[model samples]
Target: MALGSLSHGFSDWAPGHAATANHAPPKEMSEEFGRAAEAILIALESLRSSVDLAELQREYLTFIQIILNEGLGSVLRGR
Candidate 1:
């Protein structure tokens, strides 16, 4: 997926600004985040109609861990 252009306000910021000085989230990273968020939402919806509560809970936790540990945490750490 193509990286959407940075918003005008962010794009126009002074180089001294933190948002400008620090690298914006890379394009691939941003796209991955979007995909991961969608996956989590889908998982939640699927779990809602699931019959086995324990299995649902296990899957939900696994999904959450992947999002937090791999997706969000890695992003925050500037991977």
Candidate 2:
């Protein structure tokens, strides 16, 4: 997989170029992906109720959308 799209989950977390810079993404991604997912899992576990998790979920989706759109725009612009 390309650095840009590497993720354990369907969600892509790391920025493409940065993800590739440190090492080939797939190798680095396993560790990095787990850490990010674990952090969110921990946050959900800490939450008092499902509502809190839902709120986090919304925010996370929005964040991912923004990243994806930016990446797409950059690509369209030939960057």
Candidate 3:
């Protein structure tokens, strides 16, 4: 898959916002947050199916592991 496409997918899946340099927003409960979490899971599953580990190079597998462990794992942990 194209890197641009992946990046675009992520941007569309979770759009970022600009925050104040020293101020963090408080968390609030919302159904939208739940939907966003579901969207992330769907994206991850789509990516997993597209990647063929058996045919992937070692470095590429390591990259995938880093994304899964550091990226997705942190989100799942509510960090």
Candidate 4:
């Protein structure tokens, strides 16, 4: 997605096709998002060493939940 669209999505937590006012993210929030992205990438890369399929899948889902429920949730709430 375009950066502007992504920023607006985060601001409103609405579908891309929905009409909502677009607002630029603050610099601190943008920096936090960059850090979060980097951390997620590093975690995924580290998962390559896992030797068990079921365990890896479980861990991946947990990671996804943490990102969606906690990480993004906090960002969206401006907490």
Candidate 5:
């Protein structure tokens, strides 16, 4: 998905922003977020910083951990 498509209006970002009362956003949104997450991970891996290599590894792992802990099945379910 294009990065431009990710920018939603204010209401779109609000809690329970779904077609109905659902815990997860729509599948499309989740997929888009997945793409965005990958892009972020790539940057986190490639960029150099004064921060220790261990810190960057922690950041990368933490990002994946957040998504997995949430449960991918729940995250992609459509409202």
Candidate 6:
């Protein structure tokens, strides 16, 4: 909850942060990531709203990895 500590925590994505000086992803790639992230959220929301959707086959193990690495990655790669 401390302000000073937050700098380190948010260094990566915070706009204009020194830590992201040259480490930031390219704009095109980041924009694609943004789209993919949004898609993942929409997928989860759809599942949550469906009465009988039940659980999703979230790949081998990790949730984000399934959505981001596989589905989204394939979708974005086509673009």
Best by lDDT: 2
Query: Candidate 1: misplaced stretches above 4 Å?
Result: 1-21, 49-79
Global CA lDDT computed for model 2: 0.49
| lDDT value, residue 20 of candidate 4 | 36
TM-score of 6: 0.37
Model 2 poorest 10 in a row by lDDT: 1-10
**Model 2 lDDT per residue over 1-79, tens place:** 1222333244344455675444433434345544555566566676737785677656654544434544455568999
lDDT of 5 at 41: 59
What C-alpha lDDT does candidate 1 achieve relative to the native structure?
0.45
Higher-lDDT candidate of 5 and 6: 5
Cα lDDT, model 4, residue 14: 29
Model 2 stretches with alpha carbons more than 4 Å out:
1-25, 55-79
lDDT of each prediction vs. the true structure? 0.45, 0.49, 0.37, 0.47, 0.48, 0.42
- Candidate 3: what lDDT? 0.37
Model 3 per-residue lDDT tens digits across residues 1-79: 3421242223112213244323321133223333444454555565655455333323333333333333444478999
Scored by TM-score, the top model is 5
> Which residues of candidate 5, in runs, are more than 4 Å off?
1-21, 52-71, 74-79
Name the 10 consecutive residues with the lowest summed lDDT in model 1. Answer: 1-10
On TM-score, who's better, 1 or 4? 4
Q: Please estimate how well model 6 matches the true structure, expressed as its whole-model Cα lDDT.
A: 0.42
Backbone N/Cα/C clashes per model: 0, 0, 0, 0, 0, 0
Per-residue lDDT over 1-79 for candidate 6, one digit per residue giving the tens place of the 0 to 100 score = 1222222232144334587546644456544545544565565666666544333323211333422343345477895
- C-alpha lDDT (0 to 100) for residue 42 of candidate 4: 63
The TM-scores of all predictions, comma-separated, are: 0.35, 0.34, 0.26, 0.37, 0.41, 0.37
Q: Between 2 and 6, whose lDDT is larger? A: 2
Clashing pairs in 6: none
Residues 1-79, candidate 1: write the lDDT tens digits: 0111212122232223575555444556545646654655565566667566445445544443433343455579898
Residue pairs of candidate 4 with colliding backbone atoms:
none
Per-residue lDDT for 64 in model 2? 42
